[model samples]
Target: MSHHTAAKLSRSIISRLGTRGFSVNISETTQTFARLRPAFAIRNLSTSVSPNGSPKDEKNNSISSDKSQNDKIIPSYWGVAPAKLTKEDGSAWKWNCFRPWETYTADVSIHVTKHHKPENFRDKFAYWTVQALKYPTHLFFQRRHMCHAMLLETVAAVPGMVGGMLLHCKSLRRFEHSGGWIKALLEEAENERMHLMTFIDLAKPAWYERALVFAVQGVFFNAYFLAYLASPKLAHRIVGYLEEEAVISYSEFLKDLDNGSFENVPAPAIAIDYWRLPPDSTLRDVVVVIRADETHHRDLNHYASDIQCQGHELKDAPAPIGYH
Candidate 1:
């Protein structure tokens, strides 16, 4: 079959899958999203040899052996088990596992700028969650509030995805710091992607339907803004609020990570351990990094707002984009 036909077939399957959940429509869209996939192809495939004619696995082992002595081996701060430890549980063990710097390299190139959109059941739920938050009625699901927060997180990631793509596109055009920035953007995308999924995993079927409506509403809001670019002052305040919210949510997530609640969230999960090592990288360090990134993002809104309302009123304002 032609590639186009194959794609259409894949999309059709995705649509059918979407209907099983509360969000039938938005699930179809997210299922078809091009940017969400990772880059590896390990299924039903055999390992290959290296360029020098040695088996790839052998080469990898050789390299590992060479570096084993020089590589800093440290004990895992948390016990090796994946048991769910709560906040009031053993503090020392939990804190140790959270050490951000001790983490091994989190290879992210597997999905960055590649042709795969990672599929997790959570994507459909996330799309629906966004829809749910868009409506006033769904807000009535009060105790289901965590579902709403998750939707906000997934929606918030859209801009960052765009920014990441822009960075990549820019790199292609200029070939300057493109590679490094691409890596960073890809990592950010992966992290946000997992964050969205975690929320979906926690939500129920009914919540998914409410979430779908909310996602539609969010789309409408964006469309409305397109015609009426928010005033600089209004935009700044709005962006500021969003950044603050992101900071708070991520902080809570980090705290949960420390308590071992994060581990229960499941994998292909985006633990800080995915990229930054624990013990050396510590959860506190990760939190601090995330906070700094959010602050910078918030500061951009302040500048954008100033430009919109003050007519370049703040000469000292930061550049309006390239946050992170």
Candidate 2:
């Protein structure tokens, strides 16, 4: 193709990609694309890149050095895909750590090793225990606010997830491993029940504030889920977005588990592994397990989108007012 024709085609492709929320710089992405032409010639191109000493292409030269600086100040990449400003998982970690092990004093006073006054020791212990209990409660309130923020932040993603899921499902239909996708959905559905139940069992009257916050979340999430079924194309994107939310939510739970300081987390008997990290002691293992099912869910929706079959089946959205 001629240089003019190729550049025109590149711009057209960039415009289409932007509509789908792919927002890297067109010229830069196009240059990258050209470099990978040989790889795309074969099916199943890897999305990852390895560092290589390839010469700067014409597009890079055309752009000014200040372009990168300008891009950094824009608060977005070409004004398409939105950024996640607050890290909910990191917030969860902070809340969990604000209160470590709960401190309580023994009736029988033990002599202090460093600071020897028994009364002073007892007073310090009491003050710290009261403070510890309040810490988680305060943190929980902050988390509730943040959860609200996330829903607002990701509102635009609704259509994108729905569309993406449909595209993914349609693409996966040719593969024989379709049943696993259904199984993953079933598992997530079942887990929601336990999650609600656990919340009810441990939730205190004061926790109603948090519950109200979650109820609002339920409205958005349930509607999104319904839309997924009503329109699988949209549903796919909704679920994909939900999976991302789940990753953040569960990671927060894991951080709380490590600290062992939830204000009202249930006893082990009430809910097995209710507040504990997954059996394996590594963060990688926890993240992997949490992400795997979501990925499976994403894959299944992708496959579902691929399927040309149709139905108006509806599943009830999870309740908006669960104790959790």
Candidate 3:
């Protein structure tokens, strides 16, 4: 109820009580009534003014008003807010991380079983490095899909951001366009981070696992940054192999869901919205889409490495913008 309407009702109640011959304490009755007020209604109330021309409560009311103003973020300019979005069925779009327009149906039929054989020293080094990294993760998580995916994504998200930042700097230095490589790399990073978000909703990791992610991300980010700076070709090749591993991991995840090892739980709301899956989609559906995503990442990174290896800059070929 509005403050003015509430005040009128409060006075009516007190008048009725007085007429009914009840010896009532006005202050106590008002206090009791105030206690019964809805929380939102009680909020931002001007302090009680005892009828003695006192300024005593004014200070408290001003303080509370100041705090309320400080806590609430009001839009400052005409362009501050974006238009609200609705889903296909006209329900409000609930996600802030992604928009409905950005969402798409996963191409589940895409052939995912492709591999790149190491033909050169750089390729061999990248392949071996990825192999070395994978063994430790396998030993640690040991078949815990959710924990493993969460950990994997923390490392997986590093490459694209690092690569994008470097290319962005190069573009700035040369005063030229990146030919969409920057956006492509950054989008890949966002997608990888979203993978982590989805996994986390399904499983809460142990404290030690969370601690490990903190340490691992700090170290891996710097290491990958240096690796990309030294050789973009090698860095992209490494990520290509890493994505191949992700595809394998996700395929196994799908199998576990099917074979009754992992529960085929309903997909997280975030996953459903981001991937534009049906409301009835299950974890199995989530895995299929995720695996398909990994396939794209694998091929995209390998394609990126190939472009550089062929002595052509990434700008020479069109980057797959919004390819996912």
For model 1, residues 1-324, the per-residue Cα lDDT tens digits are 999999999988888878565464776676655334221213323444346533334224312222222233222212122333323233322323234333334322221111112133332333343345345534543334445456555555554454446556665776555434345434444445544554454555465656664775478446424422423345334544456555655556566677766443332223443344344444445444545555555545444444555564322343433344
- Per-residue lDDT value at 22 in model 1: 46
TM-score, structure 2 vs. true: 0.31
Q: In lDDT terms, which candidate is top?
A: 3
Q: How do all the candidates rank in terms of TM-score, highest first?
A: 3, 1, 2
What clash count does candidate 1 reach? 36
lDDT of 3 by residue, 162-252 (tens): 9999999999999989889999999889888888889888999999999999998999899899999899999999999999999999999
Clashes of 2: 11
**Once superposed on the true structure, which residue ranges of model 1 sit more than 4 Å away at CA?**
1-146, 159-194, 197-210, 213-224, 227-233, 248-268, 273-295, 307-310, 313-323
Please provide the root mean square deviation of candidate 3 (C-alpha atoms, Å).
15.0
Which portions of model 3 show Cα errors greater than 4 Å?
1-79
Better of 1 and 3 by TM-score: 3
Better-scoring candidate (lDDT), 2 or 3: 3
Q: Pick by TM-score: which candidate is best?
A: 3
* Global lDDT scores for all candidate models: 0.45, 0.39, 0.84
